[model samples]
Each structure stands twice: as structure tokens, then as C-alpha cells.
Target: MADILSILLSDSFWAAALRIATPLIFGVLGALLCERSGVLNLGIEGIFVAGAMTGWLAVWMGAPLWLGVLAAALAGAGFGLIHAILTVPLGLSQHVSGLGVTMLATSVAYFTYRTALPDVTSPPRITPFQPLDIPLLSDLPFVGPVLFQQTALTWLALGCVFLVWYVLNRMSLGVALRAVGDNPDAVDAQGLSVYGLRIGAVMAGSALMALGGAFLTMSAFDAFFFGMVNGRGWICIALVIFASWRPGKALLGALLFGAFDAFQVRLQTEVGAMVPGQVFLMAPYILSIIALVVAARGADYPRALLTPWFKGQR
Candidate 1:
């Protein structure tokens, strides 16, 4: 109990929580956009892996770090387009298409990584993004370091929460998006192209998802590795449900998950041999499952979710 309390009160623990949550926030916001448009993007996990690999590869190949990040976003957008084609125009099963995409993306990343660095004698590395301390904010007590001192991507992720909320609640595009998610046929009756809107949302959302993956290799760690994403994509799916599909709520959910993850890491170090490290590692996932169960009943899923839309078919 004393050890847990000490760790909880430490500034470093909270800081780590924000750091861990950054990618989850990006992923949840991305998933939120696609799901809100009546599309269940299962390709997110693949896009994430693809982004991490492509971003790291870009930096290794001598491109600027920002350019690498852009490359990752673009790669994610490309995959999103493929998913849009499969689920929207082709009228395929969203679940199958999404899973196929994940398999393809992850496989392609592994192949590319192996081909590029065939000799694993020395793994490639890059100068990852470093933390930047916000002047006045970082100087404050308690909240300063935890909230203010983080990488640029972390700040951008925080901004994205607000951006998604504003776009979903305050903008005309948001209204159109929500309408399409609830009733695409009605949206079509109003002369808007449901396909176009969905495609746009998927691509845009995927770009953000890839950016999250890029953060893993470019900011979170200096090198890319197999299984680096480690099910964060799946966690985002549960988070979207837990948040009731709202961006603000998603932020809180991400933080909550992140807190569990951070605490578990601390717990493992404090308990040492008393508790197995795997148990601590499993805490976040177990909590996620429980959260999903609790939140599932009240989740207001999009009305048109997982439904294939054909213009003239009733």
C-alpha cells in the first residue's frame, strides 16, 4: 500500500500516463471518425503497424523526421482508401475486409523491414523526438511536469481531442457525418453522396491513425520492432465503445487506460519478485475488458454501423 501510494503521488507516474495515452488518443479519435460515418475500420491495427515501419524507414533512408511522419500518414491514408473501396463501393463485409487489411499491412511491414535491414546483427535506430518543457506551465507545481512537459506529438494529440469534438458538434460537416452514420439513405435522399463522405472520413481518420503509429517509432521509441503496436489498436476499439463514441469521453477513457498501464509498470518495479511481471502487464487489458462490459449496455452505436449501403436498394 505504501509503495503504491508513493508511486501514485510521484510526478513521473502521471507524466508516463500521458505519454502512454498519446497513441491511444490518436487511435480512438481516428476510430471515432470512421465509426461515426457508419464504417467500422478494422484496418486500424494494420495501418498503425504500417505507419510505424514506414515512418522509421523514412528516417533511416535520410528523409527529415517530419517528412517521415508525413510518409506514415500518407501510407495510412492509402490503406484507408483500400478499405473504403472494399467496404463502400464493393459492398463487402466490413469485418472481413478490416481483418484482411490488418493481416496485409502487418505482413507488408514485416517484409519491408526485413528486406531493408536484412542483417539483424545491428538494428537500425534514429534520433527520436525529445520532450519539450512548456515554460510557464512546466514551472507550476504538481500539474506542470505531468501535463506540460511532453513531446510535440503529445500536444498535437491533446489538440486532436478538441478538434474532433468541435468538428463533430459544432460544424456542418459534423452534422452531415452524424446523419450519414445514423441514416445514409436519408442523407442520400438529401442529394449528398454517402460514398464520398464515408471515403473522406475513412481517409482522414486513417491519416490520424498512422500518425499515432508514427509516434510509436518516431517519438515513443527510437527504433521500430515487430509487435511494437502490441494491441493498442484493439484497445482503441474498446475505448471508442467505452467513450460512447464521444471524443471528450474518449480522452478520459484513454487517460484512464493509460493510468492503469503506468501504474502496472510502477507496480512491477515495486513488487519485484512478489508478483509476476506478466500479471502487471496484463492489468491494462483486463481493465479494458471490464470497462467494455460495463460500458457496452449504454453505448450509442451508430445506427448504420456495419451495414452495407447501396444507393437504390431498400
Candidate 2:
């Protein structure tokens, strides 16, 4: 009890929790946006891989960091566009389309990596983003260490949460997007293009998903590796439901999972021999599943989700 309490109360724990949640924040927000617009992007896993690879590769090949980020976003958007075209206008199975996209994107990224480095056994590393010194904030006690000692990418993820919330709640564009998701016929009746809104949302949402991958390579670590995404994309899909499609709640869910993961790491260090290491690894996921089941009970999902919306169809 004392050891666990000490870990929970430590500033470093919270800092690590936030850092671990950074990629999730971006991923959940992306999934939320896609679902809001009536699209389910199971391709998120592949997009994450592609983003991490492309972003890191760009930086390694002499492009600037931000440009590498752009390359990642663009790569994600391209894959997203493929999924959108297949499902939105074509009215295909959203599940099949999304899964296809995952395979396609993953294959492309892996192929590119192997093609680029035919003989290299080790993945190359790039210069990652350094933590910003937030002046006075960096010097504060617990609060400073917890909130201010993160890379710019972490802050960017936080900012994106606010931006997504605002756009979804406060803007007219958000209104249409939500409407399109709930009832595309209604949105189309109001002179809005249902196809356009859904496609655009998927593309934009996918861009955000890729950014999550970028964070892995550009902020969390300097090198990209196979399996580095480690199912974070799938977790995001569930977290969106756990969040009930709300940005603020989505952030909380991500953070909670982050804390669980961070705590498990500490717990492993404290009693690695007593318990199997795999149990510690599974703790956060098991806890998250419980939370998801509880929160998802009353989750009011988009009405038109998974329903094909063909423009002009009565």
C-alpha cells in the first residue's frame, strides 16, 4: 500500500501518464471525428504504422520535422480517402472497407520501408522533438512537472482536443457534420452534400490519426519499429465509445488508461518476481475493458453509423 501510494503521489508518475496518453489523445479524437461523421475507420492501426514510418523516414532523409509531420498526415489522408470512396459514395460495407484500408495501408508502409532499406537490419533513428522549457511553469513543483515537461507534440495533442471539442460543439460546420452522421437525408435536404461531409470528415480524422503515429516516432521515441503501435489504434476505437463520442470524456478516458499503464509499469518494478510480467502488461487493458463496458452501456452513438447513406435515395 505504501509503495503504490508513493508512486501515485509522485510527480514523475503523472508526467509519464500524460506522456503515455499523448498518442491516445490524438487517436481517440480522430476516431471520434470519423464516427461523428458516420464513418468507422478501422484502418487507424495501419495509418498509425504508416504515419510513424513515413514521418520518421522523411526526417531521416533530410526533411524538417514539421514537414515530416505533414508527410504523415498526407499519407493518412490518402489512405482515408480510399476508405471514404469505398464506403461513402459506393455504399459498401463500412466494416469491409475499413478493414481493407488497414491491410492496404499497412502493406504499403511496410513495403516502402523494406524497399528503402533493402539491406539495413536496424531501423534508422531521427532527431525527436525535445521537451519545451515553459519558463516559470517548468520550475513549479508537482504541477509543473506533470503538465509542462512534455514535448511540443504532447501539447499539440492537448490543443487538438480543445479544437475538436470546439469544432464539434460550437461551430456550424460541426452541426452539419453531426447531422450528417445522425440523418444524412436531413442534412441533404438542407442543401448540404452528405457525401462531401462524410468524405471530408474521414480525411480530416485520418490526418489526426496519422499524427498520433507521428508522436510515437517524433516525440515518444526517435526510432520507428515494427509493432510499435502495439494495438493503440484498436484501443482508440474502443475509447471513443467509452467517451460516448465526446472530446472531453475522450481525453479523460485516454488519461485514465495512461495512468493504468503507468501504474502497472511501476508495479512491475516493485514486484516483478512475485507476479508474472504478462499480468502487469494486461492490467491496463483489462481495466480499460471494464470501464468501456460500463461507460458504453448508455453511450448514445450516431444513428446513421454503419448505415449506407446514398444521396438522393428515398
Candidate 3:
């Protein structure tokens, strides 16, 4: 109990939790946006790999860091466009198209990495984002390290929470986006282009998803590794359902998972190998699953999610 209390009381633990939550914030927001517009982007997993590889590659090739983020976003948008075209206009199976995009993006990223660095045995590294050191705030007893000391990208992720929430809740575009997701026929009756709205949301949401991947390579670590993304993308998908499609709840869900993750890492060290390391590794995921099951019971999903609409269809 004492050890657990110490772990929770330490400022470093909370800081690490926030850091761990950053990528999920971006990812869940992206997934939320897509779902809000009646789209499910199962391609997020592959897009994450592509973003991590391409963003790191861009920096290694000497582009500015922010520019590398842009490169990643554009790459994600391109794949999203493919998914949008197939599902929206052609009215193909969204699930199949999304899964195809995932496989395609993952393969392309891996092939590009091998082709670009054929002779290298070890992945190269670049300078990563450093945490901010606010003079007064960073010196505060507890609050300093917990909030003011994150890297720029972490701040950006937090800012995006507010941005996404505001846009989804307080704007006309958000209203239309939400409406189209719930009842496309009604939106179409009002003369709005359902195809265009859905396509745009998927593209923009995908762009945000790529930024999460960029955060992995640029802020969390200096170099990219195969499988580094693991299953964060899928976790974000479940988080959207857990959040009931609300951005604020999405942030809370991500932070809760982050706290669980960070706690397990510390607990693993404290137990000193008495418990198998795998147990600690799986703890966060198991907890997240429990939370998802609980919250998903009452989740209000977008009605048109998975239903395809065609022009002039009655």
C-alpha cells in the first residue's frame, strides 16, 4: 500500500501518464471525428505505421520537424481519400476497403523503409522534441512537472481536445457533420452533399490519426521501429465507443488508460520480477477492455455508421 501510494503521489508518475496519453488523444479524436460523420476507419493501424515511418524518414532526410508532421498528415489523407472514394461514391464495403487500406499502407511503409535503408542494420535516429521548461510554472512543487513540462506536440494534442470539442459542439459544420452521420437522407433532403461531407470528415480525421503516429517517432522516441505502433490505433477505436463519441470523454478515457499503463510499469519494477513481465504488460489493456465493456453498454453511436448512401436514392 505504501509503495502504491508513493507511486501515485510522485509527480513523475502523473507526468509520464500524461506523456503516454498524448498519442491516444490524437488517435481517439481522429476516430471520433470519422465516426461522427458515419465512417469507421479500420485503416488506422496501418496509417500509424506509415506516419511513424514517413515522419521519421522526413526528419532523417533533413526536413523541419513540423514539416515532417505535415508530410505524415498528407500521407494519411491520401490513404483516406482512397477509402472515401471506394466507400462513398462506389459504395463498396467500408470494412473491406478499410482493411485493404491498412494492409496496403503497412506494406508500402515497410517496403519504403527497406528500400531507403537497405544496408543499415540499426535504425538511425534523429533529434526528438524536448520538454518545455517554463521558468516559474516548471518550478512549481507539483503542478510544474505535471503540466508545464511537456513537449510542444503534447501541448498540441491537448489543444486539439478543446479544438475538436468546440468544433463538434459549437459550430454549424459540426451540426451538419453530426446530422449526416445520424440521418443522411434528412441531410440530403436539405440539399447538402452527403458524399462531400463524409469524404472530408474521413480525410481530416485520418490526418489527425497520422499526427498521433508522428508523435510516436518525433516526440516519444528519436527513431522508428517496426511494430512500435503495436495496437494503439485499435485501442483508439475502442476508446471512441467508450467515450460515446464525445471528445471530452475520449480524453478522459485516454488519460485513464495512460494512468493504468504508467502504473503497471512502476509496479513491475517494484515487484522485481516475482511476477512475469507479461502480466504487467497486459494489465493496461485488460483494464481498458473492462472500461470499454462498461461504457459501451450505453454508447450512443451514429446511426448511419456502416450504411452506404447513393446519390438520388430514395
What is the overall TM-score of model 1 with all chains considered together?
0.97
The local lDDT score (0 to 100) that residue 45 gets in candidate 3 is: 86
For candidate 2, write residues 1-314 as lDDT tens digits: 99999999999999999999999999999999999999999999999989989999999899999999999999999999998999999989989988888888888888998898888878788899998879999999998999988998899999999999999999999999999899999999999999999999999999999999999999999987878988889889989999999999999999998998999898899899999889987776677678779877798999999998886778
Candidate 3's error at 153, in angstroms?
A: 0.6
Q: After superposition, how far is residue 283 of candidate 3 from its true place, in Å?
A: 2.2
Q: How would you encode candidate 3's per-residue C-alpha lDDT over 137-175 as one tens digit per residue? A: 999988999999999989999999999999889998899
Clashing pairs for predicted structure model 2, backbone only: none
lDDT of 1 by residue, 1-314 (tens): 88889888999999999999999999999999999999999999999999999999999899998899899999999999999899987889999999998898899998999998998866679998788888898989978989888898899899999999999999989999999999999999999999999999989888888888999999999899999998889889999999999999999999988888898887777776898778877777888889999999988999999998998888
What lDDT does candidate 2 reach at residue 48? 91
Per-residue lDDT value at 120 in model 3: 86
RMSD of each: 1.2, 1.0, 1.0
Each prediction's Cα lDDT score?
Answer: 0.91, 0.91, 0.90
Per-model TM-score, in order, reads 0.97, 0.98, 0.98
Question: Distance from true position, residue 174, model 3, in Å?
Answer: 0.2
Q: Candidate 3: lDDT over CA atoms?
A: 0.90
lDDT of candidate model 2 versus the reference: 0.91
